[model samples]
Target: MAEAYPLKFQENHKSHWARTLRNLGLAYHQIGDNTQALDYAKHALDIYARLAQDKPKRFEPDWAMSLNDYANLLSDKGDNTQALDYCKQALNIRERLAQDKSEDFESDWAMSLNNYANRLSDNGDSTQVLACAKQSLDIYARLAQDKPKRFEPDWAISLSNYAIRLSDNGDSTQALTCAKQALDIRERLAQNQPERFEPGWAMSLSNYANALSENGDNAQAIDFAKQALDIYARLAQDKPERFEPGWAASLNNYATYLSDNGDSTQALVYAKKALDIYARLAESNPKKRTADAERSQLNVAMLAWLITGAELVVSAEAAPDSALDYDRRPNRFYRHVLLAWAANDPAHAANALENAWQAWGAMSKAQQKNWENIFLLACGFAAARAALPPAFGTWQVQLTQFKTRRKAGLPQWMEEIARRKGFALV
Candidate 1:
């Protein structure tokens, strides 16, 4: 047998030191030490960067690679600000390399554009994100046009992301159009190569369902989501490790459609199944996957509880019953409002509570915390106007006296209620 030299590390080599830091970062990240991983990652990038500055021309590829590495790591760490900086730098390097070297060829350009656009979108900058996603779509579109049979799958994904971003930014109509176009492309591809392209079919079906759901066609959405779920279930069961989360996610999406159409019992069943798959995945390998996916499992469990009024048993639980680790706060508030309304006016308040609870129960945590808060507030105002008693005027007066007497110790929700009633004595 031939003798092999053992790997060795030296103190003075900056490159080796950078590599060491990166490896340590991954190790730390694996064990759920985000802070330490972030520190090590930053140190590695700093060293790589110093080397790039020392030899700018020779280190172009290294520089770009390091920037992307840092960008992705930081983005995962949720430091989107610094992640944006690194992504932009990486884009600049890639653009220069592709333009000045490869004449901006399709393969390299498309890859770079995809990463750049996604990162820009990740940080929630609409203008730049839209521009980059559009540019990438254009590139992919052109490539697919030039070689339809070869690049169709890639093009389909880009178009899907393009539509998704548009939908996120409130252009649901345009989003449906984009999604439809991608579905057309993918359908054709799947027909041409069914054996190799089954996943593409599933993706197109799921995306079409998403667009339909956004457009309020929940009937068609449910049908399409079910079709996708069936395909993904077969594909995933055949290769569990390879397709576990995708199938689980399809089940989740299908369940969401059911939940939206007032079939939350079925939704709870599917969400629970998805949560099981996600839990297994998390236990199998947490560090290698996105935390967003793990968080989503928690979301499913929370929503299941809201739909069924059943408590979810999760791995991360604490006694105070806080909403931080749960996605059921909207439903919780909706229930509180219902309790209040039952006490106030059981007839009209019944309808008010019903509508409000539906809206509140269906919201995702991200949605509830953001623009949905405004909608919730607006709905509260509308409900109050519609359901407020004639005695509310006198009630407001009483609330003013109560507030003045208890200003130093009023609970926040009580204070909000008083303000909402326009009960101001000052």
Candidate 2:
């Protein structure tokens, strides 16, 4: 098509060529070839921008849409700064277009707002997250009221985003309300059109489960999480390459819930599975999947530590000093639970701490140094469990020393934990 068309000509052929380029870009994005996606998207956007600048009435919408697609690819590639700029440009154009042609551009405006909100949330701009999310929800709500068949799905999506923002802001009750509303809408949509809406339904179910878990409804949370897992399992069976990441994420959430519920063995299984999936994904697309892969690895390591802690707490048994069954990291929840359990069963605290410390000492110097933050965190947990506040303070002092002496390579999680626990990190 590009060969057949002289792009310099003022004809509809340019529009056709641009559409083809844009579709190719979108296809590459869907298949996770983000490099090619960005290449094609930028080329399409260049043409659309030229056309829109030449004749705004005919090509402005296309230009805005191309901007949106480019922004989405950039966002997927973790370039939120560039993504936000492109998304803002798209939003400005869509807002202006909607003001003149509400019926034609209202949906586009809502979509652009959603994209902007997502980028803002990724950047942790909490103040702007709620504003963009709420505005997007309001627009979608009005549009869905007027055209349910056309806009309800978008409205449901906006509700989910708003619910996440609310959850992050610590409004668990309202977040659950919004999540449930989105779930109900998705359920209805899926019942009427399963093939078209099942994926959305599953995603909403996962979000709803997270909200329920945050609200302390563990039983109900597992029910919804399992439902989402079931759906994603089927979807991934059909298209593993496309849906496996979602499946792995759902598994991770379920594993966290199970871990909190004291199902250590099952939680370990789920965590390992999630880590395996993320490892494969990272191998295929390291640039995009490395963060998730590393986080999933951390989850697996935490689960291993939790299992060891739980067994130590329950069996009142000590492992050999040289055992390597568990990594020497401290999980906040697991450590807290062990401390609480030791409060009632004081007899095992000394043995558990001794064995855990020995296990750490058995590790190679490189491994111990590699996990210095985790080692300090574990020491703090042990000291707190032993009713030795001074010992915990000593560990914190050591952490401060490490931060002061070593200017880099310190784990950010240690600083966050210190800040959250009212301890001075620096």
Clashing pairs in 2: none
lDDT tens readout by residue for model 1, 1-426: 996554222223667788888889878866656667878887887887777777766556666776777777776655567877888888887777777665344545666677777676655566776677788788778877888777778888888888877776667778889998888887787788876887888888999898787676778889989989998899898988767778988987887778667676787788888878877777766654434355455556545545554433344222323322223344444443433323345565455545545545444433443333223333444445565433233444443433333223332332343354443222
lDDT of 2 by residue, 221-322 (tens): 778998998998899999988789999988988886676455767878988888899899889876556556666765665556455643222222233223
- Number of the top candidate by lDDT? 2
Residue pairs clashing, model 1: none
Q: Which candidate leads the pack in TM-score?
A: 2
lDDT of 1: 0.64
Candidate 1: misplaced stretches above 4 Å?
1-58, 102-107, 190-197, 286-426
The clash tally of candidate 1 reads 0
RMSD of each: 11.4, 11.6
